[model samples]
Target chain A: MMSFVVGIAGVAVFSVLARVMQSAARGTSPVAILAIAAILSHLASVALGIIYVPQFQYWSAASIFSFGVMSYVFVFGAVYKSVSLEVLLAVAGHPDRAVPLPYIVGHQVPEIFRGRIQILIESGLVEQIGSTFAATAAGERLAARIARLRRMFAIGDSGLYDFPD
Target chain B: MVGLVTPAMNFLPGPAQTAAICLGIALPLLLLCYARIPGIRGAGSRFRIGCATAAALFAIACAVLPGERRIDDVAGGILLLATAMLLVYVFWGLLAWGFTLTLLTTLAQAGRPLTEEQWAAAYTQGGDIGKFARNRLKLLLGSGMVAVTGDTIAATSSGMAIARLARLVRLATGLR
Candidate 1:
């Protein structure tokens, strides 16, 4: 119980630290900020546990801490820029909570598509040249590795949910 | 007084925690084995099977391991295994289905510069961006987050609630 309490306290510290860091540095990636904070808090929690809590099982503390942190990250990632959530939010924000399917199909989805392309470009993975896009050398290497893994695992590259055929 | 306050220190892991550590290590090895098996087709199914196998083995280990079962030990073991599963799933999901990663892979496979139209086509295997939109819409509709009425879509009541929750999460996570 002491370990679990300490683990949760670590998570709380991570949350507070992440928010502060994000507020202080606007341009930094949230995921990276969260990672740094999580590591720091986790180490602190373990150290404090060892110093204060008698019978503090290392694995017990680690397990609870990992679960808490991962769950936090999972929720963060899901709500970050999920397209389905974006669509839902868009419609829900509308005056009538509705939108034309064509508007979504034509305007919103393409905007999202372009937004992702911009992200890739910013990440230096893809390059833009005269209204066309191509992968950079680094991007090619990564893509090749991903392709190999997909082939090995028989995973489709479509990136679409594989509904029953 | 100090001695009365300080409890006994035992840093050793419980039996179930030991079992969890061993089974957690075995999960990725099991996934590698599953990759070689043609019977398991999709990444999702294969991963699910791997997790199920690890869980079954953990149960077996708990039952067979020579230690009196304690609730805390069993619970800790479960949490550990769950953490491992979540970690591996996130990594595997990124490699298998990450949108940005797929976009990169698609462009790299193209071997040349592609216009927006060509890129979208390649991304969807000859389909337009509409296909991608429909795919996402399918998820929203399937999950009852939205309802389609001929040409328009509306968020359901539950959808609005979820949207509100998502907004709260975004605010809390400092994504705004």
Candidate 2:
């Protein structure tokens, strides 16, 4: 009966943790929540193990505790590194393009023409600008250019283009 | 009074019972996944049928297994192996679903509908922040579940070990 109770608690703890992580990704400070959850869950599991499982002696208890700690550390570290990198890139004024182009067109193109119709709004560039009509025209032009370039360079049909095609 | 209770009395229904419990949990989840996922429907009905058949077979096997010996010695191993394979497929499904969700969300946020190629390209990059966020959340949930389940198993096993040792010590000391 105690084991069953512990199992239910374990499931609840993990479920809450999952929801917290999702919330964090949706723009919440999830790291602190994650850390707290990990600690609480680990401790709860250990306490329950001690009560219910006769086999979880001193050595096994120590091992399990250490494993839990290590797992928490690893997960937290990975999340921190990835989230920090994403935040930094976002802050650095990178124009949010769905896909990366080889020439940094979103950033560089606007700078190149200074103030000539936003370059993004220019003919054959609208596709990258996120306007439907412009995107379609730009896409067609890009496809043609890519086909021409590939043929001119005798490139295989690998679909390689200087821009995202 | 506790000593008067037989060992068998504490042992539950064994392997067959455990398998039955898992199947009961898994079947509904599998059905939910199939019903909600449009991409899977478009890909093929065959896959869905195969999964349904597999789930039924597993359920029947669990129900028919008479005791711990039949379930643990044979069926449990096979089930574990199959579960591992299903997990791999689920991982792929999650990744694809995550990518699609991210792309759609971004486009909606930007107040536009993405073209087919753009959508395709976005998914191929595998590094969109929104998509990454979704995938990470899924992984976190998955790992968290494993950790919790493992803890419970470890705790239960430990308690059993301690009880056995106490019994042995009592026997040696002639105190029982």
For every model shown, the clashing-pair count is 0, 14
For B111-137, candidate 2 gives per-residue lDDT tens digits of 444554443344335333333333332
- Candidate 1, superposed: residue stretches over 4 Å from native: B1-12
Per-candidate TM equals 0.94, 0.29
Per-residue C-alpha lDDT of model 2 across residues A1-165, encoded as one tens digit per residue? 333344345545644564556455654444455556656775676566555564333222332233334343343333332322232222222333122332222333223222322333343343444433223444445545544533332332221111211
Output the number of the DockQ-best candidate: 1
lDDT of 1 by residue, A25-136 (tens): 7888888898998899999988777777887777778778888888888888788868888889999999999999999999999999999999999989999999999999
What DockQ, on C-alphas, does every prediction get? 0.67, 0.03
TM-score of 1: 0.94
Task: Please give, for residues B26-135, the per-residue lDDT of candidate 1 as tens digits.
Answer: 88788888988988877889899999999999999899989589887888899889888888888788876687888899999999999999999999999999999999
Top candidate by lDDT:
1
